[model samples]
Structure formats: C-alpha cells, structure tokens
Target: MAESSTARVIRLRPVDDVAIAAVDVAAGTGVDAGGGVVVARDDVPRGHKIALRALRAGAPVLRYGQVIGFAGRDIAEGEHVHLHNLEYREFRRDYEFGVDARITEVLAEADRDTFAGYVRSDGRVGTRNYLGVLTTVNCSATAAKQIAARLRHSGVLDEFENVDGVVALTHGTGCGMAPDGEGAAVLRRVMRGYLTHPNFAGFVVLGLGCEDNQIAALTRDVHMRPEVPVFTSTIQELGGTRKTVAAGVARLTEMLPIANAARRSRVPASALVLGTNCGGSDSYSGLTANPALGNAVDRLVRQGGTGIVGETPEIYGTEHMLVRRAVSERVGRKLLERIDWWREYTAKNGGSMDNNPSPGNKAGGLTTILEKSLGAVAKGGTTALTDVVEYAEPVTTPGFVFMDTPGYDPVSVTGIVAGGATVVCFTTGRGSAFGCAPVPSIKIATNTPLYQHMTDDMDINAGGIVDGDTTVEQVGERIYRRVLAVASGEPTRSESLDYGEEEFVPWHLGTVM
Candidate 1:
C-alpha cells in the first residue's frame, strides 16, 4: 500500500473507491491503486479520477472516504469517473455539533511571530497604507476612477514614500435598488467597511446626486479613527464631473502628507486576520494547494490570529464536516441557517447549487457540486469553527470562522475584506487573476504546469507537493512565511499588475427595482 514518488495515481484514503491520476493516462496504461494495479479502460486526463474497482449503477463513488456522487451507469475498474458516468444526488448528513471541536494551542506572546505593519489609532494593524476614493453609486464610479488615476499617474505619490498610492473602490450597483432593502443594507455595510478599513490611511466618499444610496446616509453612523481624514461629496454639490474629480484630487492631495506620516511598526502575528479562498479549482486542489493553505491557516490560528473561509454554495455538501468542528451548537446552527438561506435563495432564482463547477472546473476533473465542495472545504484547516457571520459582517472572533457569501471570487473576497481581513490567501488550479486593494492577496497554484504557465501571476507553487519534491507542511510553512512577508510590505503579483481596482465587486442581492 506504500506509494512511491512516481506513482501514477494517488489514493487519498484506505476506503476510497477511486484514485486521482497523477498525470494524463492513456488507455491500457497500468496505474497503482494501493491494493493492486488497475489497467486504464479509458484515457484519463491528469487530475481526473479513475475507478479502483467495478461499481454497479446507482452505487456511491467514494473519494477521501466520503461519497462524491452516484454512478449513473456501471463503471469498470480504471474507467474514468466523470460527468458522463457520475450524477449528483441529495443525501442526508448528521450534524454532530462540537463533536470534533478542540482547543487550539495558542503560542505565547513572546514566542508569536511578528510582521511590520501600520498600527492604527483604533488598535488594529494595517497591511498596506493607501488613500482610497470610494463611490456611493455606479454613477460616480468614473469620477472616483479619475481621481485615483490622476493621483497615481501624476507622480504625486512619489513624494510620499510611506503611502502605497491612491486607489478607487468602485462597484457596478448602488442606485438601482431600494434604499432600505437587503441590497441597500448590504451595500451600505460594504462601503462603511471600506471607509474605515485599517489599510487605508485616509479615504474620500464620492456620490452622484439622485442615487438611492446617498453619501450622507451611508456615512451617517460610520465612526473612523480621528487621525484618519475623510471627505464626502457629490457631483451636483461640486458642480459637475470635472469639478468633482478636481475637488476630490485636491482634498486627497491635502491628506497625502498626513497619511504618509504613518509608519510600519513591529506587531504580533495575532493582529493578522487571514482570508482564505479558492478559484478555478481542480482535483489537485484538495491534495495540494487547498489543504496546504489550510495547514498555514492552522499555523496562523495557533499563533492567535484569525482565519476566515467563505464561499457558501461551494461548501454545500461539506457543511456537516464544519458543523462537527463548530465551537458551540449555537454557532453550528448559525452556519446551517445560512446554508438553508442559500438553498431558498438559489431555488427562488431557478438555479441549483450544482450550477457551480463551471466548465473550467469540469475540465480540471470535478464532476459534481458534491465532489467540488469536498475539495473546497479543505482551506479552513482543522481549527474549531468559532463564529459564522452574514456577508460583509465584521469578523470579531479570534480563531477560525465562516462568512456567508456566494462562490463568485470577487464578491466573496470583497465580503472577507469588508469583514476586516488584512490579507488574503487564494488558491487556484485554472489560474484565476485576482487582487484586493489595501488588503494584499497571495496566489498559490495547485499544480506545477499552471504555476509555470502563469508564473507572473502566481506567487507560490504548491505543485511541489504533488510532484513529491515537497511535503504539505513544508509548502504550508512557506505560504505562511510568504504571508508575513507580504503583510510586511511585499507586493504580490496581482498588486504589481494593478488588478485590484476592477475586482472590487460586492454581492448584489434582491430586486433591481
């Protein structure tokens, strides 16, 4: 049952009915399946699953010792197990709340890791020091972009060595929905989060007249650090687009000196709140990047830092696993409530949770939502699930937590950042290009080919684990160290390419009217 470094197939568990192809396998090729070698009955692409034994139709296919899906037809040994033969089926899950929850061994303060960070007057640590221009509605998006563009390209930031540069946080919706509905409430919460985000030394809120989301109302209850300067205005009040842009530039220009005065100081790693997400995932995701990231998250949690994992729909089939790790039955029920809400939400929209695992995911060897969710949940590590919060809700708990957000990358990460995550760690097998301004994002590749193909975009290659060149703990420790370096001012690949501005999408829910 011992696997060699060059094993052509990987069996994750002793009870698994299938093994993952370590490389593209041609028909007639023999692959090691732990118990015995199985000859391939069909060509299996790398990262795809291969049946270890004959499976009768309607029987469950197991991976990681859990059911991934049901066989639509009889599957012969070594046959490729994918869309053509696998089918999604609903099943019951027992929620044994707190059954697996365990206390984390927090490191002593003197033994904890440290990172150079900008400490705000509110006692929060910031990973980046940028001045942000936030838009109240899509109508003022252009003005916000122009203000940031002018400052970025004008050589104005060169004078302030400590400031990261000005960024425009714009979105597509703000005016078309009811002001008091869930949509507006969500938008207001997101804007307010960005307004006071510790990463921004100062910020300006711009709005266009006649929008349901008024600048005044959005900023009404927002309380910011007194040292952080904030300016709010509208296009009509400032005369026009030209005037608004010019006035915004002038105000930020005045605040630049004050923002630049901030300096990075050594802070305990406990001050870090890590946001974890995965996109463009493949079968190798669970084996390589995702679990490796989870290891790193465990390390962070042990150091007394917080780790947030989201993507609610993507975790549908694996919520029971998390429920067992919940710190309390109340917290576990809260997560179940969100899952129920998503079920109703998707059903109301005439969609199914199986709508996920896009074409890219399928090509990468995922067959059903159940199969995908099993891999997706690996990013949370084995820490106790302390709290579950609504989308864009501030994450106050110190251990591992879950946030309710869609599987869409941008909206999910945006919610995490809004909840006060200072840095983000993203894993991908299909090469998802992403970034979050102010909050630095570290991209980890699930396989070697994708990392080499998109070398400029990927920050770490977790593929070493798949290739037998490294262990999960080694790659995980590397990711954890890279996180500290990035938080201490290292620019990530996405940051160098300026990918954050356009990716700041908030989840738009409810009616447009």
Candidate 2:
C-alpha cells in the first residue's frame, strides 16, 4: 500500500477504526479518512493512531483489520489514540491451522540467484571466513576477549587477507548455574552451533577449568570438519590470564594461514538462511520496514532459501496469522505449544504477555503489545510456516520457519544465528544498533527521519514507503539484492562499525544458581 505525499493520514484497511498520522497533525486540522474528512480533536504525532470515528468506553479499537486494544473511555472522532486511552486485554483467537498455506513457486535451478560463499567440508555455505574464540564460562570471558583482541589488533590478520576478523564470543552466564539444567543445555547447544558454524574457518573453546560448563563435556560427541582446527584451554590450566591469552593468540596465529587459505566460490541462493528480527520499533515499523523485510523474505523463499523469524513474545497477538499459514497441523501446533509455554513462562515469573512495547517503543507511538505484534509478524512475509523449532535448535527446513525465542533483540538474534542463519535483516524504527558476528546483519530503518538520523548504521531506507517515495516491493527487492551482496562479502554498516562482538548473548533459562 502506497500513500501520497500530501496524505495527512494513512488508513491501512477499510475496516480500520483508526488511521496513522502521516505527519504531526495539529488539533482542528482536517484530515481525509477515506470515507470523509474528519477534523482532528487533538494533536496526533507522526506514527501515532488517530481515531476515525467516535467510540464508547469498552469499545474495541482496530487496525490492520484486527483488534489492537479496547478504549479505556469514550473517545471522540479524530482523537489521538494511544496508551492514555487504549488498554490491552485477553481475547480468544482461532488457530485454523494450515488455512492459508500456499505452495511456493521455487525458481528453476538454472534461474536461481547465486552468491560468493565458502562451501565448507560439511557441505554448508559460509558468508564469512573467520577464526573465533568461544568461551565456556563467564569466568573465562576476559581471557577470551584478550586473546581475540591481541590477534585482532596485532596486525597479524593483515597477512591473511581471506580472514574476516577474529572475534571472542563471550556471554554473561555460563557459570553459576546447574550443569545438567535447561540453561546449561542451551549454552552448550549454542556453543556447539558456533563450533560447527560454516562462518568460522576454525575456533577455540576457552574455559575456566572449574566451571560447570567444562570444555570436555561441551565438546563431547560434537564434531567439526576435520579440515577445521580447534583448540581448548582453561585459565587454570594455562596458569593465569596473561599466559592463557598468549597461548590463545599463538594458536590462532598458526591457524590464520589455514583460515586465509579458504576462498569464496559461487553458491546458490538456497544456501542462504536469512534471519528476520525487529527492534527499537515504532508504529511505522509495521507500515514500512517490517513489511518491506517480509517482501524480501518472500523473494528469498521463492529462490528455495530458508527464512527464520523468532522473538516469540513479540508475535503473541499475530501468531494466529502464522498458525494459519503453517504447512501442516503439526507445525502449527508446535508453534501454539511454544506460545502456551511463553504464557506459562511469563505468568510464573510475575509478568504478563502484555509486558512489552518498551519505553522507547511507546515514546515512538506504539501503545500495546498487540499493536506491536501485528507489525512484528510482517517480517515473515506470506510464506508457508514449514516448521517451528526450539531455541538454538538447528533449522534445516527450507522456506519460512519460526523459532521459539524471547523478545529481547540480542537473545532473539543469537538464537537465530546459532540455528544457522547466514545473514540477518534487522528492522528498527527507533534505530537499534545491532550486529551478529560471522553472520552479518543488515539494518533497515522504518521512517525517513530515523534513516537520515542514523545513516551510518542503517543499510536501507524502507522509510521511503511511508514517505510515498517508494513502494514496499521496491524496497524489498533492494533488501533482497543487498542480502545477496552482503552474503557475497559486502560489509554491512554494522560490520563496518565492528558491532557484533558485544551482542553475542545466549538465552539464559532456569535459575542463575
């Protein structure tokens, strides 16, 4: 849906009870509401909702032709609709599994697009060739960081041109938890995924020796390509932090030439596993960036590639839409099961599913989690939900799939990347600074103002859609092409700023003790 530059407000659906202000609309301004012009009763900030008609207290408000919230009190026509008057409440939805699962037309092999990538010995493709330092416990984080830092800043990488960069993948909670509990299992799985990740030419597993997450146990039965070298050490065994760092740097130094020997070759687009996520969202997120990213996801699916959309909590209200698109009842049911799990998970933790749409989101015009979810699910596009996997689980299904993950941006993205996403497309209306190492993240801004404000961080301006300067398909095709180019070794804005190292967060489940 495109809008005219002169449009004062945008009505997403004919049945929508509200319209989004295209710009800051002052009180008494007459705005066209499709059916007729309505005088604004109050000032409506850009991206905020404006009621199209008066409604009594307890009346349901709709947007995108679905219920977003209920009115807290009587509202006048053209009144600003936001948190002060809108409130969230539980409502039932029909799952209707497989109701809209359409068969995708996969591009013919001869016509499929290709990108330059490194084909690993295990037959997986990698968009980057890098040596990584993996920490088994938080106690070893400093040593891990020092090791990666020494190699990265030593100018040693200058000799190995094929290497992308050495990175230390550290986390905050590998210890102070049960060894055989859910949290430990998740940590181990994430570490294993990175160990076998095609993005890394090789990696070292660093531990604190006395932590519950021991290197021996973590690597047990885990296999890496024989051609890929791996080393394991502990601060205790290495004597101290300085010695551990020295040993790590020396070992990785020897492996740099081996890593540099790997070269990129043309691979089919099917080799790409694109992860979709949105953060720092505003009302325009649904209108612009998210839908545009969804369009690109559709294009990738048509090429026989995989697309993973997670952040389970953020999709609460719109899950029924995804459920209907599931390719099978089993896949749809799995998604609902995860949703139920989150409901119980949040309830037991003294929280409600409605505890979302952060302060930044509200400040940017988002009101409720329901409203936020409607926009969030647009990142999946109109593709069949081929499968739903647990957090950090391997994503082998082609086409679009869902993963169970928290709404926190870093944790959600870490799960997606761990599940084998070779590239990520992150949409932001409030300008989220994020990156996932090894797998590059492409940032798309939801509004022209945010894009122009953070030009250095944003990769594409999907905001053009809201500006009436471009269509969703146009921006989507641009995003899809950018994905290919980035997969072929083009540095994304995030990578250029070296933003991925600090964002390596793993989902922490169960008690810290």
Candidate 3:
C-alpha cells in the first residue's frame, strides 16, 4: 500500500513466522525486535525473509508458517537461511484421502454468474474470437501456413476486427510416428484439445491424409464436432498441396464474419482458469513472486475460479506440503505417483531430478532441486490440493490442480495451457520470454532490478517484495487484478511481443522417430 522506503516492515500473513523488509537493511544494522524475533543474521535484501526465532540444525524452515524445508545447519536469529545452509530431507509422506475435506463454495456461485464470451453451441466459452488452421502432419505445415499467408494478404483479417489473428497450429511430429502408441496418442489428444478449445471462434482441420495419422482416424478419435463454424479438408481430396491451400483459403473467407462477431463482456472471476508456473527462478522467487502469486491463487479460488500449478519436477521435494492439504489422499497419492514416475523417467533417460536448477538458477542463488522446490510450491498458496492429473489431462476440479509436466519452462507451461488454463502467471528472476497459444501469459519479475531493466517484458514487479515497498498480499492483489484485466482484454507483455507461436512446444518423452 505505502511506497517503499526505509523503516517499513511487512508481514505476509497475520500468523506469519517472519516479517519481510520493505527496504534493504544495511549490513551490520540492528533490526528492531518487533513482536516477533530477529531472523536475518546477514545483510538482508528488502524482499527477503527474516527468522521469527533461533533455529536448530535440521529444524524445518517456516514461511507462511508452513514447513518449506529443513535447515541443513544451525541458523541464528536475524540470519538469512537459504540454499547454503538448507538441505532437502526425504521422509514418508502421510496422505489423508477424502478425510476432513472441504468442497469449494465458489463453484456454487459460478453456476449463476456468466461472462459474455462466445458461447459455443457445444456449451464451452470462448474468451477470444479467432480462426485456427490445424495441420494433420508435418507434411501439411507449409500448406497450412500458405493458406494463412494468403488470408492475411487478402485483407481477410481487416474485415474481422473482433477476431484475434488467425493461428496455424502446426508442429514437427505427426507422420512416421506410431499410429496407436504412446507418443502418437498424446499428440493426438493435444491436437484434439486445441481443435475443440473454446478460445477458437472457428477452425479448419487440414491433413495430407496419406500419413499414418490419417484425417479420418483423427476425426473419429477426437469426436470432431463443433456447434460454431468449422471447415475440414485433405490434401488428396483437394487435388494435392496447391489445391488444398486454395480450398482452405476459400473456406476461411466464408468463416471470417462468423468469427468476427464475438466480443468481450464482464465475466465473473470463476470463468478464469489461472495457470501457475515459475522459470529462471532465483532465491527470491519463493520468498516474493511465488508466494505473491499464491495469495492471488487463494483470492481467485475464493472468487470461484480455477488455479493450476504444474511442472511435476518442480514440486519434487515439497510435494508433502501439498499432500497434507489434499482434499483426498487419492489426490495426494496421484501427485506422489507422478513424482515417482518422474524419478524413474529421469533415471531411465540418463538424468536425475537433482539435475534441475539451470545454470541461471544457480547464478541467482539456487542450489538443488530440494531448495528450488521449496520456493516453487509456494505459487499454489494455502489452498487445499484439489486434484492431481496426468500430463495435459483436462482440469475438472475448480480450486487448485497439479498437472504432471517436466520443469522445462516452455514444455511445462504448454502442458498447463493444454489442460485448459485460460491465463498464466509466470514468475521469473533472470527474465524469460515465454508465451502460451490461445491462452495469454502474465510474467511477474522476481526482483526489482530485472523488472525495471525488462519493463517491456514483465507485467508485474514482484521485486517490490525485495525492495520492501509492498507486502506479498499487496503484490498478490496487484497480480490478481492484472489477471482479470488481461482476461477482459488487456494484452500481457508476452502477448505484445508475439512470444507464443513458435514456442508451442509440447513435451516429447521418447525419441523423435
């Protein structure tokens, strides 16, 4: 609330174990003993946390008064506890499935409130109006793009002011892949999801038709049906590539007006599905941006919305925290199963989860997966873990759901969006240029320096946490407001930069045959 300056202190929660500095405390300065104890023994930055009391070696470190991790060594009062002295310890996690559970009350309220989104006859809502060009295989990518290019040249978009840019959803893999196997199956499902995604006002499904992934089979598997506008084609049927492009363009010309008729209206927050992720993370991510977003997650959940925290590897050492808050042990165990799968997945792939924390993260003061995870999990806030899902599984539970995905920034985020996240809140310290297709991404800078330097890229300055200018809740509220604004039509920094199209990379587990 107040502008950042010296002599300001803020608490994250009423019962928080520590207070964060509103301004950077000089080295060797005596921090006044507030109602709580001094925790920082070193020169602490504005957004960093201080201890509430003396901590013994191996004692669990608390933030939001929750066990984020354990102190690897002794931590003195007023001393900073971070990567150097904290270690991740594995223990048997206790799961309480379906016990002492609370159903989200907001779902009931959302049943009544509605947004003026494009209500597809299929019963899904479209936040933005757009025409989509879908390719069945790599063989058809050029043709798909050519069709889109022709539409652009024809003044087609100029005629449809309400529609967003026509997007050609093409990728590297499709044919030469096994037709009925794992990779093919996953890719097929993802493609189906996009074809049917509520965001598209209209879509054209194009295929070379001779590839292993035949257009007939894909349509059958996806149950391809739409209440609004849709056009389908095959290269063989349209007289090959050149003829197919002409046909596709002709089809799009007719669909433009129908796509342009959609507009945005006041929508209740419940219609919002917020995707939570962090990238280029630093020591302060958990302390500032993550928790700040967590508060926003809680606020959204309170308002009858959905929040998804993905990146299964990022949640490695801190999953127990989520388990304890799980509405059902089944949900908690589902998360654990994913964690176990990753362990085996990495080992078989000649890697380990500990091999995370990219060079950038280490330079920013992060050490191991355990240390990074402590901060990573903070983005979920204090809500009960409502559900755990497989990669790109449609998120049905409203509050907070965890989707299995690798921690790779682009790949992980793609899974979150595919799972139906309408808006994404991404936290970064080293600055990342990431975007989501159909869905918009909101980037929050973890520290003030990066925020100011990359003002064009970052949407929110959670670095205020380190500057001692605002509390986590204040920044959280700021992010929450931005989510609503972006959902309602404000373009995020990533959207302005056109950072999502080529970055539509889905995670590939096996070899690219």
Candidate 4:
C-alpha cells in the first residue's frame, strides 16, 4: 500500500465495506466512491467515513478483519458510519495463533547497527540529552524547583540548546510510607529507572536530609554513577533550604556545557526503542490506533527495532494470546507472573482488574475488561513474544516485549522510559494532552473529530476506521511513517507546543503517615 496525504477522499480496503473521503462532502453530490456506490448522500468531510457496503442493524462492522463494533441501525451504501450509528457488541474472541502472524526476519549485521545516541556509562542508549534535578522527598520539591528555576535566570540554557531541559522530578509519596512493602518496591524501581535513564546528561540529588527515604539510600539503590557529576545536598547538610538550593544550582551550572555538546545524528531504526500505550480510550482505540500501532510495532521489529507495551491491568484476560506466542516458557511464565501479581495486588487493594473502563469508556461503548483486552492486545501486533520483564528493567530484546506496570498512564510510560524507550506513541480517544520528559511522545487520535478539536496535541488520526475512509493497515502504515519522521527529528504536536516541561511525573508509592 502507498501513503497519501489527508487532502482527499481515500478508500483503504476493498473489503473495507466503506470509503473515507479526505474532505467533507455534502449530501446528494453524486459521489463516485469507485465501488458502484452513487452519491446517495452529500457532505463528507476530510477524515470522515463513508460506507462501502450496506450494513444492517446488529451486523458487525469489520475493520482489520476484526469486529470493532456493530451497526446500531440500518444503513445504506455510501452513508456515514460513526458513533451514532454503531454500538459495541458483546464479543468473545477465539485465539487463532499465527493466523496472520509472521516471524521478524533479522538481517545479518542489522542487529549491530546503532543510533547516534548518548551511550550512558551504564550501557543504555538515550535519544535525548537532559540534566535532571532529583528530590528525595516532597519536602524538597520546592527547593528542587527553585534550583531548576535558577538555571533559567543564570543563562545556563543559552549555552546548552542540545540539552533538553533541567527537570525537577518530584512526587507526593516519598516519606511516612511503609519502607518494605509493595509501595516501597515500586517506588524504588521507578526512582532507580530515572537515575539510570540514558536521557539524563547529568543530575543532582536534593533532600530535606532527614526524610524516611534517605538521600543516601536513594543514591545507593538508584545506582548513580561515580563519574556522572552527581552532587548531593540535604537541608541539614547545607544548613538551610536556601543554601541547599544554591549548592544544587551551582553544581548543575557546572554540568550544563558538558550536556550541551551532545547532538543529533543519523541513528539506525533498530536503535529506536518505542513505547506503546493508550489512554482516554474508547471502543475505536483497539480497532484503529492500537492495531495501527501494532503494524508499526511489526515494522519496527522487522527493522530490528524494539517496542515496549505496558498497562498490565489492561491486558488481563487477553494475556493467554501472548503466552501462546511466547518464544520460551520462561518468558511466558514471567508474563503470567506479572498478571498473577496484579491480581493479588488489586485484590489486596480492594479492587479487581475488571474494575477498569472509566466512565468515559463505558459511555463510549466499551462494556467489560474482556471486551477491552481483546482490543488492547492489538497494540502488540502479531510478533512473537520476545521477552517479559518487571517494571523499569532494561529492555535488551529487539522485538515486541511487555513490561509490567500499573495501568496509570504516567506510571506506565515512566517504566517504558526507564527501561530505555527513546520515544513513545500514545493513542487516545476523547482527547488527551499528555506529554513526557526525556523521551518524546507522539499522540494518535482514535477518531477524526477529536483530532480536529485537539490538533495542538494529536499527532496522527486513526478515526478513518470508524469513518470507513481508510483501512487499518493503511492507517498502521501511516503511523509507521510518522514514527520514522519523529525519530528523524520532526517535532510532534506535543513537542511543538512545548508540552514536555510539565510531564515528568514519576510514580509515587507508599502512604503518608
């Protein structure tokens, strides 16, 4: 399939049962949709959908050859297909393993090619250069922010355009929490991931000095390198808050020029680590954006690249599909273990995995976790399950892999970035304005109108599926192309809007006393 711009009407698949026009057309315009459909109606807009075949009430509307939803009412050929005319049905999916699966053929020496990334002292590749300011507890958050704020006033960035920014990573749950429970363990994993993240050019650790999470323990557990220009200051050690902040700023200023020298150069696609996630999701998310992303995931794996899919609770019930594709029993076991962990974790916390599908999801037509999982799994595509790892563990395999993480958007993406994802692709319905620090994020809109309404944040639109204007494979290919463009330095919508600055939220575990 070839790529086309969003300037005209385009039909994606012959079996698509629909044709989507690029621009909106009015009714009774004698529309020639190329498949024996006359202009039965007018007024189709760009990115809107039109039917290719006649659909009856309760009949399934197929895209990507999967039932995305059913026709809510009878429709004629060449008519528009969207939310008003369709409703999600109760779907029971049978696993047809490898029915459409193909193994990723790794070419000789392809695995050895690398991107011109900042090879961290710890052996991870970073796609961005950033100087991070770490706070040991919420008590020091204002101080950490003050330190970062001082950099702007000091003309430090004037000499460091190559450096992303000086971000202060602070959270709400660092002290008074259980020191050795699930909360502590998750917090440690998240914190360690940030300290060792390749995107950081240099960092400074700050604290009130006497909080339960000692700066000393964080430094030890996070494994700050002896040579990475890490400076530490506690209010106690530095005599006061103002003094501590001053010390941190001074150390970061010294590291600025060193970070600024890092530059972007041609990097092989395999060096790309892609993070896959979906938020504010609706029924069309699994149908359009998710599968489209799956196609990009397949292409990246074929190019010897790596892609990571998180959101453990969201994948419940559909995990068996991945297990059947697992390359080793160990990998399968690891995945199952995470699922088991989530089950126990949620049970202890007085919830269930089925307690998902926010009010938005239910209103938008998704009924149950079973329904959502069948669609969510489409994000992984048809690749063999390469490996499974815990939160923030390094991703070394070159194909599709899963990371265990909370279903929360920020936390899940945090693990992906920590595990070394250089970029992220997020799919959303009902619009999302999320951004991430260190790694770049590209947002794909699940429906067309949402893309138009929130153009400031959306990078791609997968609504063509619902509009009957494009095929899933065609949209998938479009996403793949955008990935290459973003990797090659094209600024995504989030980047253009400077959304990265406020998005560096780390997961907080444990509870305040």
* TM-score of every model versus the real structure: 0.99, 0.98, 0.84, 0.79
The TM-score of candidate 2 is 0.98
RMSD of each: 1.1, 1.2, 4.1, 5.6
Could you tell me the TM-score of candidate 1?
A: 0.99
Which segments of candidate 4 are over 4 A away from where they belong? 1-102, 109-116, 121-123, 221-227, 508-512
Taken over the whole model, the C-alpha lDDT of each candidate is 0.92, 0.92, 0.76, 0.74
lDDT of 3 by residue, 26-52 (tens): 655555434533434587665455555
2 versus 3: better lDDT goes to: 2
Q: Find the 10 residues in a row with the least total lDDT in model 3.
A: 1-10
Badly placed stretches (over 4 Å) of model 1 are 1-7
- Kindly give the stretch of ten consecutive residues in candidate 4 with the minimal lDDT sum: 1-10
Please give, for residues 32-140, the per-residue lDDT of candidate 2 as tens digits.
Answer: 8677888888989999988989989999899999999999999999899999999998888988999999879999978999999999998999999999999999999
Residue pairs whose backbone atoms clash in candidate 2: none
